[model samples]
Target: MGQYPDAYVQYLVHFHGDRDYFECHEVMEEFWKAHPEDPRSATYVGLIQIAVGLYHSRRGNRAGAVKMLVSALAKLQPMDVRTLGLDAEELERRIRNRLADVQAENDGYTDINLPIMDPGLLHRCQTICRDKGLVWEAPSSLENDALIHKHTLRDRADVIEERARQSRLRKEQGEAR
Candidate 1:
């Protein structure tokens, strides 16, 4: 089996363990940003979209869920992701199933596990989950407001500040022109 990165392991842990899809996107996105030239760039994006889609689905955002999941399915196609220790076929199948559910406006959230093809990778992720005091394959806690509505509930001061800074810089550049 190929070597998996620490961030990917953490992504799996948060994904299957705590059902924190937001964290799944975070860890994988950070890794993707750091390793932009990695061979798995498209795969990373597809995985991130999967997480975001699930998050939106759980939050009852049907339109958002459909958008992300559809994009994810497209990005994942025409690429072999088995090198990343994931069952590419199964992953695609699951994404399709999820997309269908979302398209039908089911309004039900289900935990989607990334099919880890490598035993070593699965073991490593499970070990990390155990160390972090999380149960593997736990279902999403529907009643957890913070988890369900993380995007709106979490602090975004830094994001807002950065956006303002960018706007100011753009305005200054326009004035110079």
Candidate 2:
């Protein structure tokens, strides 16, 4: 969490661009694994929980949303959200608001605009969102039959290849030991 990892920026890309909340979890989890000993690992995990919670909320999974959001808040309690380049107070407020709705099973999933505190980072995220034809902070189409829910319908050859490569590296390193 000291020098923000490249994965965090990539997480923002998927978050704003594709609205692929699952990928947000993957990228951040990978980074968190690399720094398990970091004192702030809980903050990283909390962010992943936020992503998954939002994903569940969008899919109308009220129960799942509440569980993840509650766990995330607990993990986030001891840390300052600004330490991760986010507007800490606003994020907590948004999470709490979302949680209330989730618990009630009434309000729909709201677009959580993670207020990035750093001007430069916000500019970069905005530019990328523009390039991708996505509007930052816009609520995604969540109609029951919408295509976003079927994201796995798209090909993921690149991801599979990367997983295979990483598996080989780990197997080889173990043999060397």
Candidate 3:
């Protein structure tokens, strides 16, 4: 739908279809960066936190999961999220339940489906899922180790190089000053 950004729709697709929470975080973070002044900035951060929380939770990082989900809940407001076509109350309730589960030291991971209130948005996500050969609202594939442990497993050479370059630039600027 034209109502949503491509990155947001991509985020929803990865989030529910493949259950790739890491990818969800990536897409939403890009959107947030590109539109820092957008009114939905806070909501975007909350959404990214949700994905990161779920990723940590599924990886059995209870402390990390609890921290991210709590931050997400704190940052998100029902009215603010409603503007993004999500069921704000249900989303809050789900995050709270997930936080409770993480705090209680639940040993298993469960897939969470964001309560998307817009039919058009849902259809758009489903279409994208089909195109990508993924199932909509699929259960977590626990056997997929790459998806489960993406943060630790994925290559970060590019990220490392970028950080180094930024640091070098800052040093150069300071020297000039």
Candidate 4:
């Protein structure tokens, strides 16, 4: 197994395979929130921005794409991509190129194919993708027409119930104190 967390691996797989930007954000965000003290929080957010930015681009939201990509580039500029087991120079070059493409706003969306330097990590990601019956390195798409916008069809009951449960717990604890 690689030194990275399962969440990071999941993020990579969803990124390279399913191209589910929203899912990428969820996995990475959960990891970052769980380990807030880690220096990788910014890194995770940058990765999230890449996914969301691509999603926006694919959906033809030029303005949102530009904003997210710009923010991602700025966050990643100061960090060494190798810390996340990637080729530092190549990753930066790709991001720079992507930023330019996004700024031009001609194409709908560009795939963010980051270079992975770690063989083990790459292998693990590919394996996960295969296990999940997805194609690696394939550009993601909202092919499920009805599922294009997740919130429009997803069930939010569990999330709402969990939030209410947490709220009740907090209130009970406050009263006890």
The candidate maximizing TM-score is: 3
Comparing 1 with 3 on lDDT, the higher-scoring candidate is: 3
lDDT to native, each model: 0.88, 0.80, 0.91, 0.79
Predict model 4's lDDT versus the native: 0.79
Deviation in angstroms for 81 in model 3? 1.3
Model 3 misplacement above 4 A: none
lDDT of 2 by residue, 1-177 (tens): 345667887788777766778888989999999989877788889989999998888888888889999999888843457776787778888899889988888765566867788877777777887988887766667763433465556578998999999999999999999
Tell me the lDDT of candidate 1.
0.88
lDDT of 4 at 57: 74
What is the TM-score of candidate 1? 0.92
Candidate 2 residue runs with Cα over 4 Å from true position: 1-3, 77-80, 143-177
- Candidate 3's TM-score reads 0.95
Clashing residue pairs in candidate 2, if any?
A: none
Q: Give the TM-score of candidate 2.
A: 0.77
Question: Between prediction 3 and prediction 4, which has the larger TM-score?
Answer: 3
Backbone N/Cα/C clashes per model: 0, 0, 0, 0
